[model samples]
Target: MTERLRRALDARPRLTRWLLAGPGAVAAALLFAMAMPIWLPKGAAGIDNIVFPLILVPLIWAVVFVYACVEESLLRCVAVICGTAAVCGLTAAMAFTGWI
Candidate 1:
């Protein structure tokens, strides 16, 4: 079963890579941005957290996308992207639940 799944994924490398570089990167970036507010310190007017995440979103996306595209190992790329998204998502969720 695992061999078959591996073969199937290997059959269409471009499609897999595109999927990772596109939607996967976007999701990771968004999750990271969402969690940023929880850790970022407020400035004088108390809006730095919001504004900093907004400004960094595009850069984060680009960095993730590039890493996904350029990485030699597809599995590693997936792991990194998913791990980042999961961590950030958990952070945001914990914050929302008042656990942080």
Candidate 2:
């Protein structure tokens, strides 16, 4: 890894990094699952009743974009919002599917 990357990784404890990264990773996984129907082969079991938060993506992006336009802080609000939204969306989807 580059020195900068290594330093960034080493600055945070393993557990802290995992906790910080977990939500985004889970969101990415859920997003991928939501997109799987496009790749599933014919005659395979199909996805049903998916409650995708497609609207949330744009809404969050707009919020972030607006914040970016005026904010000077180095905070990572975009990741926070996206991660939280992902968790909420996934949980809602699961409940809607009777999986929760």
Best by lDDT: 1
- Candidate 1 lDDT trough over 10 residues, lowest sum: 1-10
Per-structure clash totals for the candidates: 0, 0
**Candidate 1 lDDT tens digits, 6-90:** 5766788889899889999999999999999988998999999999999999999999999988998776776789899999999
Best by TM-score: 1
Task: Estimate the TM-score of every prediction.
Answer: 0.82, 0.35
lDDT of 2 at 21: 42
RMSD in Å for candidate 1, one decimal? 2.6
What overall lDDT, based on C-alpha atoms, would model 2 receive against the true structure?
0.47
Cα lDDT tens digits for candidate 2, 13-84 = 454344434544445545544543333343433323332333344454444445434433223433444555
List candidate 1 segments past 4 Å from native. 1-12
